[model samples]
Target: MRGRDRFALPILRRARRDATLTRPAVSILLPVRDEGRFLGETLASLSAQTYADFEAIVVDDGSRDASAAIAEAHARDDSRFRVVRAQRAGMVAALERGRAEAEGAFIARMDGDDVALPGRLETQLEALESEGLTACGGRIAYFPRRLVGDGGRRYERWINGLVTPEAAALDVFVECPLPHPALVVRADALAAAGGYRDCGWPEDYDLVLGLWRRGARFRNVEEVVLRWREHPDRASRTDPVFAQGAFVSCKVDHLRRSLLVGWESVVVWGAGPVGKAFARELTKHGTAVAGFVDVDPRKIGRRLYGAPVVGVEAAARFACSFALGAVAREEGRQQVRDVAAAQGRREGVDFIAVA
Candidate 1:
C-alpha cells in the first residue's frame, strides 16, 4: 500500500467530500498507535479547546486495538474531527500524512496520550499572531502524579523557565527547550523548514533544530498548556532513536551546519563523560577538539582524545574559535557560562551550552 491507498477508503472519500469546508485557523496533527486506553481522554481535551476554529486530523497508525474506532466515533459526533487510517507507518510518516491533509494556517501537535489545557490553542495562536513568532510552545505538566519521576520534574522546571525567546534560544542545544506536544507552529514556516523527518533521533528535536537553522523564531507561552503523560511505553523511553547517543549525534550534526561552521577547532568545557562523549562526536564529524577545559585539579594537564585537558585559567591559551559547555549538571553549566563570560567570550558567538 502507498499514499492514499494506505488510508482507509471511506475516510479518504469523506475528506475529499469535505474539501469545500471552510479552512480552519489551526490544524492539530495527532498520531495514534495502540493508544486505545488514553485516546478518548486526549480527544475530549481537544474538544474542550477554547479556540474553536481548528480541525483535528487524528492519524490512526495501524492501531491493533480500538484506537481507530474511538477516533471514528469522535469524528461522527464532532464535525471538526476526522480520522485517517494509515497502515502501521511510524510517527514521522503519520505526522507527514496529517500535514498533507491539514488545511489550517497554523499547525499544532498533540499526542494520543496527552491532554491539552483549554487555553492552549488560543494562547499559542495569540502569541504567534501578536509577537510575530514562527513557532510557539508552552510549559508542560506531567500527569498522573504517581508516575512523575525526578528526571521528569527537573525537565519540567528547566523547560518552564524558558518563558522568553532568548532563554529558549540560549539553551536549545543543551536540550530540546520546547515540549513537543505543547508546540504550535506557523504552517508556512513548518513547510519551509521541511515538515518532520526520522533522522535516527527524536523527530521533535530534529524539527526544532531544523526550524532554528532556517532562522525561525521560537517562544514559549509563560503558562502550562499541555498535561504531558509519562508512561513506560512512551517512545522516548522505549525507542533507540531517543537514546542519549542519538541526541548527541543530532546536536553535533546541526551544530556543524550552523554554529560550528567556519570554525576549525573547538574547546570543550567539562572533562567528564558528557564532555568526552561530545568531543568524540565532534571529532567524528571532522571538527577537531582543540582542548578540554576542566576545574578538577586531577584532570588538568591530562590528555583526553589526544587533546589536552586544561584548567579554566589556561582555557584562554587555546586558539580554538569556539567552545562548548558540555557539562551535564545545571550548576556546572552555569559555572561554564560564568567562566566564559569572565574570559570575555560571548555566548551564542564564542560558545554554546550542550549536554
Candidate 2:
C-alpha cells in the first residue's frame, strides 16, 4: 500500500460519510494498533476538545484487540468521529490514509495512547490560522511520573523551552524539535511536502526535517496542550526505526540534502560521545570532518575515531569553512557558539549547532 491507496474501499466509504454535518475545519489523524487499553481515554479527550470544528479520523491499524470496537463505540456516540480500518501497515501508511480522507484545511496529529488537553485544538488552530505558520506544535507533559525517565524529562524541558523557530532550528539536527503528537500542520502544506514517508527513520522527525528543508516556518504554541504517555511498549522504545543509530543516519542524510550540500570540509565541535557519534555518521556518509574541537586539556591533543582533537584556538584557525557543533548541553552549545563567533562564523549560515 502506498499514499492514498492504503485506504481500502470500505474504509474510504466510511471516511467520506458527511451526514449533512458541516465540513470540519481541522482533521485529527490518529492511528492505533492494539491500543485497546488506552484508546478510549484518547478518544474521550478528543471529544472533549474546546474546539468542536474538527473531525477525529481514527485509523485502526490491524488491531487484534478491542481497539476497533472502542473507536466504533466513540464514532457511534459522536458525529465528529470517523474510523477507518487498516491491516497491519505502519504509521506512515495509516497517516497517508487519514490524510487522503481528510476534508479539513488543517491536520492535527494524535496518538492512540496520549491525551489532548481541552484547549489544544482551539489554541493550535488559532495560531496556525492567524500567524500563517506552516506548522506548529505545543508543549507536552508526560504522565505517570514513575514511568517517565530522566531522558524524557530533559527532552520535555528542552522542547517546551523552544518557543521560536530560530531556537528550534538551532537544535533541529540534534533531535526532533517538536513532539509529533502535539503538532498541528497546514493540510495544503503537508500535501505539498509529499505527505509522510518511511525513510528508514522515525516518520515524524523525517516529516519535520523535510518541511523545514522546504522553507516551512515553525513555532510552538507556548502551552502544554498534550499529555504524552510513557510506557515500555511505546514505538520509540520498541521500534527499530526509532533506534539511536537510525536517528543519526536520518539527521546525516537530511543535513547533506538540505544544509551541507555544497560544503566540502566541516569542523566538528565537542569531542565527547555526542560529538563523536554525529561525526562518525557524517564521515560514514562521505562528509569530511577536518578535526574535532574540545575544551578538555586531555582530550584536546588526543585523536577521536581517527580525527584530530584540538584546542578552540586551533579549531578556530583550521581554515574553517562550515562547522557543526555537536555539544548536547545548553552551556556547551553556548560555548561552541561563542568560539564559532570568535572565528567570524555566523550561525544559520556558516555554522549550525547539531545538539
Clashes of each: 0, 0
TM-score of each: 0.93, 0.92
TM-score of 2: 0.92
Candidate RMSDs in Å, in order, are: 7.1, 6.6
Model 1: residues >4 Å from true position, as ranges? 1-20
- lDDT (10s digit) by residue, model 1, range 211-287: 99888889789989999998999988998999999999999999999998889899998899999999999999799
Candidate 2 at residue 235, lDDT?
A: 90
**Model 2, runs deviating above 4 Å:** 1-19
